[model samples]
Target chain A: MSHQFYSIECIIPPHIQNNIAEKGTPEQRKKVMGSISQSAAIRAQRVLLTETKALVEPVTVGGKQRNIFNLNFGSNLPGILARSEGAPPTGDPAVDEAYEGAGATYDLYQQEYQRESIDGKGMRLDSTVHYMKGYDNAFWNGRQMVYGDGDEDLPEPQRIFNRFTIALDIIGHELTHGVTQFEAGLVYRDQSGALNESFSDVFGSLVKQRQRNQTAAEADWIIGEGLLSPNINGIGIRSMKAPGTAYNDPLLGKDPQPAHMSDYKTIDYDNGGVHINSGIPNHAFYATAMEMGGYAWQKAGQIWYVTLRDRLTSTSVFADAAQQTYLVAGNLFGGGSLEQQAVRAGWQAVGIQIDAGDSGGNGGGTGGDTGSGGGTTSPGCSTALVQLLDNVKALIENRSR
Target chain B: MKISYRRTGGFAGMLISHSFDTDTLPKTDAEELVKLVSAADFFALPSKITATGADQFQYTLTVETAEQQHTLEVGETSAPENLRPLLEKLRLLARGKPDL
Candidate 1:
């Protein structure tokens, strides 16, 4: 049989894009130049290897999902082993990872939420494994997911045993992108994008916690805990339980996620660093899990999942998501259920409160302007928030008027 | 000379910069094809076949993350015309902005 294959690269890694985007000095520009140089050398070498490989025929009768090419995970560049139907990973570590990851995601959706494939229409799952030479990341594009073998400086082979590279949680985290895409399609910009990322982390962590038989209290609630490459900075890429504490590395700097709304970063990049500012809702979920004191999947995951599916808008923002989840929690478990209360407390912990109007509390948008009950974290917002509040007020008034 | 194609900078995933080190005719042809297809991502001047080492003409392409500004290098011992399909894939990836 012949094989058809394709390669996908990761989101901008720590070095090139982050550096160039953040800095404006000559020295920083030099570093960008150097990265460009190194990239050129690697690409040249990569082209040579792929050139010699013969075209691989597809094993499946129908084309591989959306296209006619088959993508199999392997060490060979541009190696196409088989198509998307029942394509078990064939002893290739990368393939195995992709296969297993897909399985876990599929299982999670079916078992937990009863959702269909990425599009809720049994869309054939497609993935490319062993994507690039020493590439150090994995990400889901709009259509499919791609994995990198990682670089020598990072984790070689990018392999994880119990925790390192092979963590099922991370797999779930990446795959949730598909779920988000199909559902809320949260715009990846400003607060909305951050909310989108938060939803992914919340659900991603729950998928792992539920699978591993860990209670919400017991789970670490970190996105890529053990998968952090040995030489990199920080413990993982992100932490739901503790936002900014994920890492403190020299080269990669630190995990910059702020857990509270007051500290929210309004700067718009990486679609508002959806991954970075996601820490806010992540913390909200963590707090909800803590207050609920049970398996997170039972209450917390269900709440986020349902809201993600039903309540949240495609362009939902952090506050919008928070408000929607609060309403959903009440609907799922009743207004006075512990689930709803925990939802309120959770959002409050992140310096977000269900509007008195939304909650049917004291009304007049009054009572407590109080942000948090008792948490070390504070919202990252500022006097600018007042302006935002004014804008929101005008919006409400305009709509009402 | 051996050659391959590497791609990088799309979504929130791995960075790809692939190549095969070799001195072969088909390999060189693959590189040439890729260059021809990737007109949008190239610099000025036609790719010159320079014998950098051995009897191989190095065809180089640099792709930076459109959103992240990360750069990845992909090249081959062949000319760019031989690597059309691979180059097309990279072009598609760099075209749109990823949500996260």
Candidate 2:
């Protein structure tokens, strides 16, 4: 392979490589192991360069950097530069909100979890507001945050959503997608997709709680507080504390989230109910945070963050999440500690019983397959490697275009 | 002929949908809708198209005539170029209707 090929492949984290070895097809296994060996040879030199650079650079070299843009009711992204880091806030509420929300999210990850930024490599946060006239959505478009005006162009009584940037947790949730893209690279469908959404909600809620200086007990655990118009019969978009009760309106259908394994939805829409079944894991995290007490970003958030960055693979399922989080808590706070118990109890409340004797064994029987489960042990080319290859191909295709 | 459009899975997780029969619309409006459907070649598109991205919208568009009926589910990122105008028009129409 060319040097550039090796450089790109080498960036696949070691844990993901191990996952590929364990679960990948023979062809993929061979390819990844070859790259891993090549990576090992150059790893020392890279480390030396990193150390030397760290010594030469200031301690705040990776400080938070944010750029906010305005689409001005157009679909084109990063449309016009409205604000930049450390600059005076423009009076535009969407621009200022996006800027401040990014800062709050960055601070939660940096101060509490010691992460530099969404990518943990100090990637600059970029956001665009006013995506389209009366648009009612926000998303991380694989590169940066994009916010919609959320029916603001409509008359007051007809409007359902406020501006997308109205809620800090919503901003955190979108940015966390970038973190997941860089970390687990979780497949965006089925059980893995639900896990992906759940992690975002977890950290998103933590960002809000930390911003308001509220303890886990005091926080509302709402994902998009104040994002709904007063005429809408809903408190927010999704409630972590109570998944299905966030909204019930004549205009917007009832929230479809289910709070337990027994109620796991198996619909065809929403990418196999990514937003619906997520309620199970969302409630689990809420339960864990409440059990741990104090600031959620401290203990519960730490356990979940370490699990996301280190333990999870692209195809990991809810059972894998249950098992890995339990193991991670034990590892962090000692076996049989209160923190470990809290983790176990959290999953238990959501109908997933973590096997105390499993000890993070290879696979199977951490908990019963809760409908479309067992992604980690499935035999095939590793989904993570396949996703990586697909991403590279898409990048090439886009560049060629 | 009847056409129905439903959108779901945005950040808000709200579901909005609308359906209309050609007979119920004004003649001009019905002809315009027919032109959009044909211009987009809606029947020829795949039944499902997905793209990687979180919180993007998912749309389901269904068209029915005396001869056949077709439905397509697509994520915003993977939506075909020709289908964009049809999707936008349907979205606006759906927004005008009461929640389904």
Candidate 3:
């Protein structure tokens, strides 16, 4: 707990490095350059630290009463060293970052949720630094989380505007997986899987925001923006502020995530494209929060947390999830509360329904859903759409790692 | 002893390989290991994903060093303690695909 966590960062995929290398703006270039330098320094430092020996002591300061360490156990990667809890980071920035990220995630949950651990069961949090030497990805592998140094394989990776580095959002995103496993345990495929992912995104972003001590309004609302290696012509991991706006570089192609159900791409990866299709719900939360302004955690965070706890199930579909939130809004906030109305309206904006017909009004599901159905000419359509979009974004961002 | 393994293409196009020396394994033990590893389904590669398979895993592996046999399975688990989970993750360069 005493070791400074930010001293290290995970390996950045070469592709992410390439993306940052191509940015037109000098500031962006500088930021990427600095991040690269810092990340490399941390990595080098970790190597030296690993060879040295130091005892890690307990930290009981600030709002953190519990003792949690940078706790990712490398997913048994070859030649990787599994770090013990509270162990001093081996002067490696990447290792330090992983440890720090894990500590931050653990603290976020312990401080905010009153949860004991990722399992709410005091599960030991273990992490490995210098994973894969130069891996480019990170994820929560059911038992534990592991990080990669870089994604050396993908063509779009190295030369892209944004490169891979284990940033806060990615860390936050993976940690939320444990929360999801305990709570709704959303199936890892299709709509449920997407919901699972959405929750992580929500809390993941919140973790970063909380760490910076930034109010919801003051937050950047972009996840993983600073995490990528400076090479891609894009933003961060995924844009919650502007769902599809995270990346627009030619090499990486579009973000591939659609903001609405009408545009949901039903792929087979991550269980019916859970990861890819998640953009729909992720956007919905963003839209909801923007509509309901102010510090999202106060009103919007509470509402989403309640719904996730009480209203959501492992197999809930988007429409079902929408309706559940709508129902929760009325029950928790009172009948016809602004929360309920907003929740219902939010779903509609995303081609979903909260108890009634399709988002296309009465057109029904599987019908080329869009605003072509017409709302009988109402001036509120655009405004409502924008608000809902923002609300969805906020909700999802709150749940990020 | 010869075992067959076909790991999904990784970021490096390199195969995740493991070798060990086991002279104590009985013939049935070896058969069981192969059955167990292949049945572990650690990778969970979805059919539609041409780029990469599902990284989530609960995998196991039983490589007979003396026999030169290896087995790997992705997705679905036949046993909770089976080696599939750990082996599956080891194959993934700590890059967070799925858990073991």
For lDDT, the strongest prediction is: 2
Instruction: Considering the true interface contacts (CA pairs under 8 Å between chains A and B), give the fraction that model 2 also has.
Output: 0.58
What is the lDDT for A73 in model 2? 83
Off by over 4 Å in 2: A1-62, A358-401, B26-35, B38-48, B64-71, B80-82, B96-100
lDDT of 3 by residue, A1-401 (tens): 21111001111211122223342376665455344433333333332332221112122133322222232333333234534455665665656676677677777677765665555555555444434323444555554455555543445444322222356766667767766665555666677777887877777777777788776667777766665445656666577666677765544455566788888885533456666667788777767776666666555666676666544545556755676565445444544556656777766778886542212221222222222332322343344434434544654465463
lDDT of 1 at A67: 15
* Per-prediction TM-score to the true structure, in the order listed: 0.59, 0.78, 0.57
Residue A105 CA error for candidate 3 (Å)?
Answer: 2.7
Q: Clashing pairs in model 2?
A: none
Listed models, DockQ each: 0.05, 0.45, 0.05
The true-versus-predicted C-alpha distance at residue A91 of model 3, in Å, is 3.0
For this target, which candidate reaches the highest TM-score against the unseen true structure? Answer: 2
Q: Ten consecutive residues with minimal summed lDDT in candidate 3 chain A?
A: A2-11
Worst 10 residues of 1 chain A by lDDT: A1-10
lDDT pick, better of 1 and 3:
1
Better of 2 and 3 by DockQ: 2
Judge candidate 2 at residue A246 and give its lDDT: 95
Chain A of candidate 2 scores what in TM-score?
0.77
Residue A361, candidate 1: C-alpha displacement in angstroms:
13
